[model samples]
Target: MPDLNIPVKILGIGRYLPERRVSNEELARLCGRSAHWIEERNGVRERRYKSFETNAFMGARAAENALADADVGLNDIDLILNASGTAQQSIPDNAVFIQRELGERAAGTAAMTLHATCLSFLAGFDLAASLLLARRYRTILLISSDIASVALNPEEAESFSLFGDGAAAVVLSLAEGESSGLHRAAFKTFSEGAELTTVRGGGTQFHPNAKMTRAEDNLFHMDGLAVLRLVRRHAQDFLEGLEPGLSAGLGAINLVIPHQASKVGLRSLERYNWPREKIVETLSFLGNCISASLPLTLYEAIKSGRLERGDRFLMVGTGAGLSMGGLILTY
Candidate 1:
C-alpha cells in the first residue's frame, strides 16, 4: 500500500483550566471518605473545577491562545472544530458559541463539534487533517474541553476523587514545505463492551425519568474489572498496529499521553513496557478530563519542555463507547 500522504502540521497548541483547584483532602471531606483511600486507588491528589466558567467559555480561551501561538488572527482560520465529551447543553453544539466569541473575523470559517467520548480530540484531528488535505481549509483549530466534574456523583467516593475540568487547543495547517506533525492515526471500537463504561440514564436507553434520578444511575458508572480486562486485551493490539510508522524507538518517544481515565489504566500501559519518563501523567493532579486530557497534557508537556521539536509522541484514548484510538505525532 502507498503511504498516506497527509499535509497537516500542528501550528500551535494552548490550554486553559478553571480557577478552582480541588484537592483530594477537600474532596474526601466532601464525600465523607479518607484522603488515603482516594489517593491509593486513583492516584489523584488534586483536580481543577469549573465553578466559574462553562465548557464553551473555557474552550474559547484555549482557542484564542492557540491562534495567538500560531501567530494568526481569527480571520486566518478557516475552520473550527470543538471536541468535548461534556457540552454546555445537549443541543445547539458548543462550536457555535466558540464561533461567536471569535467575532466577525471568523465569519467565513466553518465551525462544528465532534464527540466520540474520550477519543473526540483525536477524531477532530483526523477530520481536520482530511479537510486540510483536500484543500477545504488552510488552517483549522481543534479544541478539547470538558467539565467532567459536573457529571460525577459527589456522593460517590470513587467519582468524587477522579475528575477535573480543563480545555486545550491545537492548530493544524497544511505542511508548507516538509514539516512533521500528524503522521498516522487509527481508530477502532468494541461495541460489545459498550455497557461497561457509561452513564445509565441520561441518554435514549433509560431516558430522563424518575428512575433516572437515582444517584448511581445519574452519575457516570464503570465496571472497573471489565474496563481493566478490555484495556489489557486491546491496548497492545491498538498500539502495535500503529507502531510501524512511529519511527522513534519506544524509549525515544518523549511522551506517551494516554487518556487520563484512572491510575490503574495508566499503570496497565506501563506494564506493556512504555518508559516511565516518557509517560506524561495528569491523573495524579488533574484526574481524567475525558476528551481534554491528552491535549491538555500535550500543552503542559510542551510548556515544561518535556516535549521538544523532533520528539515523537503517542496518544492513546479509550472511553465510554468502548472505543479506542491511537495517533502518533512528531513535534
Candidate 2:
C-alpha cells in the first residue's frame, strides 16, 4: 500500500441488534453440545438472532440512528453504500433495499454494494474516504447488515455457535481540517485459503434453486484451524507491512477495534505484543457478526468513551476471503 492519508472522518456511528438473544445454552441444544463446550470453543456467551428483521429493515434502522447521531437527515445523504457479507436477495443489490427501507426521503439516492466478506466495512471506509477526498460525495451513508443465523450449519457446532446477526452503520464526510482522518489503509487477500470459509451456494456456481444444490451447499462452512493457521502465517508481516513497528506495539495508536471474528481471533493480537487494554471487543455478547463486527465494535468503543475525537485508532481484521485488512485513523 501507499500513504493514503485520506482526509475523511466518521461523522456518526450506530448499531442495531435483533431483539432475540440466543444464548449458548440454546445453541448447545441445537448443536448437540454442552453450553460450556460452545463457550470454550468460541468464547461467545450470547448472540443476537433475528426474528423478523430483514437485512434492509435492520440496516435502515441503524442508518437512521447514525443519521441522528451525525445530526443529519436522510435527504442530506449524498450516497448510500451497503457493505455486507450477505445479501438480502440475489437479484437486486442490498443497498437499494436499504434505501427503500429508509422510506421516500432516501428516494433517488445513489446506492450500490461493495462486499469483501467480513472486511466489507473496512473496504467501504477506504472507498468512502477516497470519494470524499475526490469531492464525489459530500455525505456518505455506509451500512452493514448480516443475518448469519439464517445460514448457520447446525451440524457444525463450532461455526454454528460462533456467529450472530446484527447491523451497524456509519456516516462519513470530509474532515474540516487535517485533524481527523485516515492515516493508512491496507488489505491483502490469500486466495489459496479462500475455500477455508464460505457459503458455497446461492451464487451462479451453486444456485439455490438448482436441483444439484445440496442443503449443505447453502450453509456456512469453516475450517477454523486452517483459517487460523493461514492468518498466523501472514498476520505479523502484514501488520508490519501496513506500517513499520506496528507489530511491536500500537506506538501512537490510541485504540484498536478489531473484527469480532471469535474469542481466539481477538486474543491472537496478544501474540504480537498488542496490549489487551487497548483493544476493543464485543464478541462475547455479539459473536461474529460478519462485516458488522468491525463497525459495531467501533460504535461500542465510542459509546464507552474509550475512543474519542482526536484519538488515533487502528481497525484491523480477517475475513472470509482469508483476507486481512487494517485502517489507521484519527477519530
Provide TM-scores for the models: 0.92, 0.98
Deviation in angstroms for 220 in model 2?
0.4
Runs in model 2 deviating more than 4 A are none
Error of 2 at 112 (Å): 0.5
* Residue 270, model 2: Cα distance from true site in angstroms: 0.5
The residue-by-residue lDDT of candidate 2 on 1-331, one tens digit each, is: 5777788888899889999999998989899999999989898999999999999999999999999999999899999999999987987888989999999999999999999999999999999999999999999999999999999998999999999999999999998765898989999999999799989998888997788999999999999999999999999899999999898888999999999998888889988789999999899999999999999999999999999999999999999878999999999
lDDT of 1 by residue, 152-241 (tens): 776667866788999999998888666566766888888978888777766666766765466577678777778778877876667667
Model 1 is weakest, by summed lDDT over 10 consecutive residues, at 244-253
Off by over 4 Å in 1: 1-5, 209-216, 244-252
Query: Could you tell me how far off, in angstroms, the CA of residue 307 lies in candidate 2 after the best superposition?
Result: 0.3
Reference-based lDDT, residue 13, model 2:
91
Score each candidate by Cα lDDT.
Answer: 0.81, 0.93
Residue-level lDDT for 225 in candidate 1: 77
How far out, in Å, is residue 187 in model 1?
1.1
Choose the strongest candidate by lDDT. 2
What's the distance in Å from true for residue 115, model 1?
Answer: 0.5
